[model samples]
Target: MDRARKDMIVKEILYWKDNRMLPEHYCDYLLALYTEGNRPKDKARKAKGFYFLNIILLLLIPLSLLFIYFTELSFILQMGLLIFFTITGVSLAIYFTNKGIAPQLPLAVSALILLLISVEMASHFFPHHNTALYGALMLNCLLWIAAAWKFRQHYFGISGLVGLIIIVISIFI
Candidate 1:
């Protein structure tokens, strides 16, 4: 085919991919075939950036835990740091989900951060109240289920259900 015809076909395929009119894999295969295996440079770079950001976000989970447990920071400062982490994780999750990119990394990171902060806050504020800690856990599971429903992510739903089951088992035991 001519250069102009190939370009038009590529643009149409991209439009279908972006609009979800065609399955992503099909669009990708067509693009590759038409482009002779050379994909867009910018898209590859953008994907790499997202993957790097996701890795950084994942690393923050462990760092946050260490900061909370090992630091001499005041309660207020710890809480501030937790809040900042939660906000960043949640914002990235929402952005990835909306952009039809790989959202699971950010979603998992956000869920973990929220779980940590909720448990920490509950235990700190209600040291003698086991019920409060359990409540915090239950609430987080519910939020995970809600997020799954909203984001159409089955893994979150499965994880939420498993969490609820574990909590119930522990409560009864």
Candidate 2:
């Protein structure tokens, strides 16, 4: 196309991006193609990070199904597996963030769930230590808040805020 048409297309893509009609990454790719000068930002890093993440996800799906079906495992064993998964997920999420890829939401969510599960297990195992349980939960919430602030993760911030509110309300009651 001619210069004017190409410019018009670029403007349209920008409009879509600003209005959230198109994904920001998609818009960036189109813009790069049209402009034929500037490169798309973090393209290689995102691609590599997501490629490995997708492979891991594909493998995890069936493994997770099997895990869910296996209810006969001992509680300690289950908790151990969950802790491993949580650590792995958090590490991958950190790697993605450091590499400028969008950190995988599922991984973060899984890590949070596993953490809560492990805490619940600990509370059960130490039945006489309600105060310790509360302390641990509160510490987890505060750490989430600090991490959210440091990483600018709105979901973490929101979850941490809700958890803090719940902890405070529980203390009053």
Candidate 3:
């Protein structure tokens, strides 16, 4: 309402947030206020959280999921995929953990595209070894499931379905 009222409100929020005594909803409220210039510090903290969360989601989650899809150790074909995801995920996490880095969405998407290619490459590697192929496919399905849950991305949901189909087809083919 007035400057004094606003200052008091802001101070109370800071006290609650700093003390960790506030509910997550309160943090959300602060985040909204901060985003709207209601409070500067809270906005900064919210932005920091988002920056790191992007790292975790765009890079971390996928990397962590695909890490299990190891095909060849020597050629490093599948391990390559694992490494690709791990590196990008870790890099993003590092890049934005402390401060916002004005993340390049294109780079992240490009890395993801490569990661997808790696999965296809891995699948092709063990065509004869149905056991390995199917097991890896199952892992892929679960990974997509997690992705779908976290991101609500239709691609993930579809990818998960494809993984299931691939696993089933491998048994017959």
**Model 1 poorest 10 in a row by lDDT:** 38-47
Candidate 1: global Cα-lDDT? Answer: 0.89
**After aligning candidate 1 to the native by TM-score, how far in Å is the CA of 107 from where it should be?**
1.0
Question: Candidate 1: misplaced stretches above 4 Å?
Answer: 1-40
Q: Candidate 1: give the clashing pairs.
A: none
Give the candidate order by descending TM-score: 1, 2, 3
The TM-score measured for candidate 2 stands at 0.55
Tell me which of candidates 1 and 2 scores higher on TM-score.
1
lDDT of 2 by residue, 1-173 (tens): 89899979988997787567988899888998998956346457647867877577545544544554567777677667666666666777776666466775645555465546647666768878877777778777877777678877777778878988998899889
Q: Give the distance in Å from residue 11's predicted Cα in candidate 1 to where it truly belongs.
A: 16
Order of models, best lDDT first? 1, 2, 3
Error of 1 at 38 (Å): 9.9
Query: Quick one: best lDDT, which candidate?
Result: 1
Best by TM-score: 1
lDDT of 3 at 145: 69
